[model samples]
Target: MTGIAILPAGRDDAFEQYKQLIRDRHPIEDIGSYLNDEDLELFRTTSDDDLVHVWGTSVDGVWRNIERNDIALVYHDGAFVARGQVLQLRHDPDLAEYLWRKNVEHGRWNEEIPWEYMAFLTDIEEVNVDIEEFTELVGYDKTYRQQGFTRVADKRLNQLSGEESVKTVIADLTDAGEHIHPVGDEDDGPTPDLADQLQAASTDGNAHEEFEKLVAKVFSGLCCAADWIKREAYPSPSQPEAGGRPGLR
Candidate 1:
């Protein structure tokens, strides 16, 4: 379980210093009993930002690997979208992350884990309002999130179009209740905020739930279409390995 702290952003010096602070170190130096070839190779190759590849036998028996990305996506409607927004529909940041990492069976920091192995943490978020739309409500009550790897093709994106939907959302939300706009006062738009949809949908009776369902359908369709890209780019072999890696030959 990871917790997010909204501290002020820092300089490159601070980031580098933070990296050094968490640099992996071996308790013992050059002792034959300390480690083995594969283990040392694992440590030497992986960095603070890179997900370590720990494959093969554990030497003690169990073998495993772990990696994480704040967001992943496939090409949908020609764009690259972050995963954080999808999760937001489920709840606030805390609740959203709770659901994303909820399914892991093993802890990354277990002492049993290799001391040389370092973990990586990343958060994928939209930079502007337009990008924010790539993220949306998960359900009527924010029950689930949707996000991942994507290749957004809209030309406006490749260019630095400074549109911020978040600002738009907050503006509309606040205007409706006089409290939400404080968050979105800068943007110029008459569009409805997310809360507006929730309220309007509530009044419309079924619109709230219907809207969320529509979101899921749209995302699923995009993902399904993107899968075909991978299939076309790299066709799968006919025979399959039941529980093992595919054979090259």
Candidate 2:
């Protein structure tokens, strides 16, 4: 089931950070400049224009439950100000430090635990839904105020039939029904062609090279780990089997 994560973008400093990171999208090149090779590669695999946001270790437990395609509702000043679909996640303190070091230097953020847990998001849109209406929709008390990052409890969403996800409920409340994609309904049109290509390649004389390419393609598609996969699959091009690698670069 697709989950919904409530991200409290508090007033003042926190809100300012939200505006800088989530509201105003950062250039990928700017972001890439700060990342180490490992994290930079991960960053590149996301949708070209996705927004990447982060949460500190305080919400690490809650963040773990947030999966790909989950709805992330940004709350601030008694309303959901924005929403987006999660595309990928990473836990890298170095990258986080680079992104939010300004806040730390200014004493706004805790230096002890940086916002290390990153979430790459797409389909982001500005929204405005009163807390009362939002709480009622999600089965929270009308007076409830979110204090931290959290996944809406399953019991609150129990009213939804098995096929329905949190995305459906939020869409209805915000009149964004047209933007909701059904849970688990990703477009897989290219999967068959990829499989066919892999099969044909496996029968070629260079079985080792074909095998490595197959692994790279599969991992790249599955987890957006194309760079990491290529690095491991072709660590040194000096090997005869690593010659003429295609489709990865």
Candidate 3:
């Protein structure tokens, strides 16, 4: 399922980074200078266009579900200022260091937090979407404010779109010439107390087993072609295979 990613760029430094990396396109030849041979090759293969923009985040876990073709909404000030489609994603600290050097110069770079999770984007469009209207369409609270890199799950989008395609709903909402009908709040009501239910579920003896199954399910969806293997069969970097270096099978 295609998803939507909200990227917050309201902070002064973040906005500057956005202007440099996202608003303006960079030639692959120019960016290639900062990448290693392996990364350069990977970037070249994934990006068919000569010019592209890179968006990165230091936050963990938030980017795991994002995939190619996901819509990226760039939020700044009180509105969404830009939108684009993610073409490629990578986690390369070396490349990120070069791209966000201002963070380093400002002494904001830490070994623990690095802007390494990247999304290469194409077909970018400048947009003007007020937060209130956007939140209404997505079924979020009218006062909802994006705090960080956030993903609106496909399930949530599917619920909001009903029979219509999520992509069509997103396109219409973001299009300047289009009009959006506010989602009805007739079903909205007092929140239900799930404390007892959560406590019972958390105390289940098979919780760990259930978690393992859930992890496997998510990973299977992410990499359908990946081979399932036992932990013993996984190669360690220190122990290379007979003919080749250690790597996933």
Candidate 4:
């Protein structure tokens, strides 16, 4: 997969620094010059790498005063082969393992994130994950893509907070006769206790009525991440592997 590595008009050394840092974690100028008047907070490399590359997703407004926005590393292979949020990036082994499991994300992410992910971020603060740090950990966890889904499912087991909310939304949708992807053993395995808990929570009859409102809230981040990679703003710089590569997506 490919993405445009925005060159700040002419900062060649800065660009080399960008590539070298990604390749070697060497120190480089944190700032660089752009075309007249507009200095760049960062620089770009000569080309985008096939295996990995870091690119700006959205810039923060305040950083806009001096280039604010979140930028993150994107993965192409391994379990974490999914389009990810810079904020979501973490060094925790467990979370890293979880992310690696969802990398390809049902094979729907070979395409870049849609521009829509850019819609909700209000400022640069939202994009603050350190790209340099994130890139270093890209494929640290060695599992294959199947692990990503397993991790998400495993996460469900201990999700005291999100499950009730998910169950409420699911129950509401089920009641409304609204068609949604059925929560199957494939992803949401049968857990009688979880089901019982879900049933107890379903007492609120309006959950069905509030379905749309609920999806709007709970699906915001997930959908935004999906939207970002699906849009034109994130096209691969060159022709992508048709149907995408395996083991990742």
Please state the error at residue 148 of candidate 3 in Å. 0.4
Model 3 regions more than 4 Å off? 33-49, 102-110, 176-249
Tell me how far the alpha carbon of residue 108 in candidate 4 is from the true structure, in angstroms, after superposition: 36
What is the C-alpha lDDT profile of model 4 across 111-228, one tens digit per residue?
Answer: 2321111110110111122333322323223332221111122233234223233222322322221122322233333343654544554454433323322332333323331110
The alpha-carbon RMSD values of the candidates against the true structure, listed in the order shown, are 20.6, 12.2, 17.3, 21.2
- Worst 10-residue lDDT window, candidate 1: 225-234
- By summed lDDT, the worst window of 10 consecutive residues in model 2 runs over 179-188
Candidate 4 lDDT: 0.24
- Consecutive 10-residue window with the lowest summed lDDT within model 3: 181-190
Q: Candidate 2, 34: how far from true, in Å?
A: 5.9
Report the C-alpha displacement of residue 249, candidate 2, in angstroms.
28
**lDDT per prediction?**
0.25, 0.64, 0.67, 0.24
Q: At residue 205, what lDDT does model 2 achieve?
A: 52
- TM per candidate: 0.17, 0.63, 0.63, 0.19
- Can you list the residue pairs that collide in candidate 2? none
Q: Of the pair 1 and 2, which is ahead by lDDT?
A: 2
lDDT of 3 at 209: 31
TM-score of candidate 3 relative to the true fold: 0.63
| Residue lDDT tens for model 2, 124-143 | 67889888997777667777
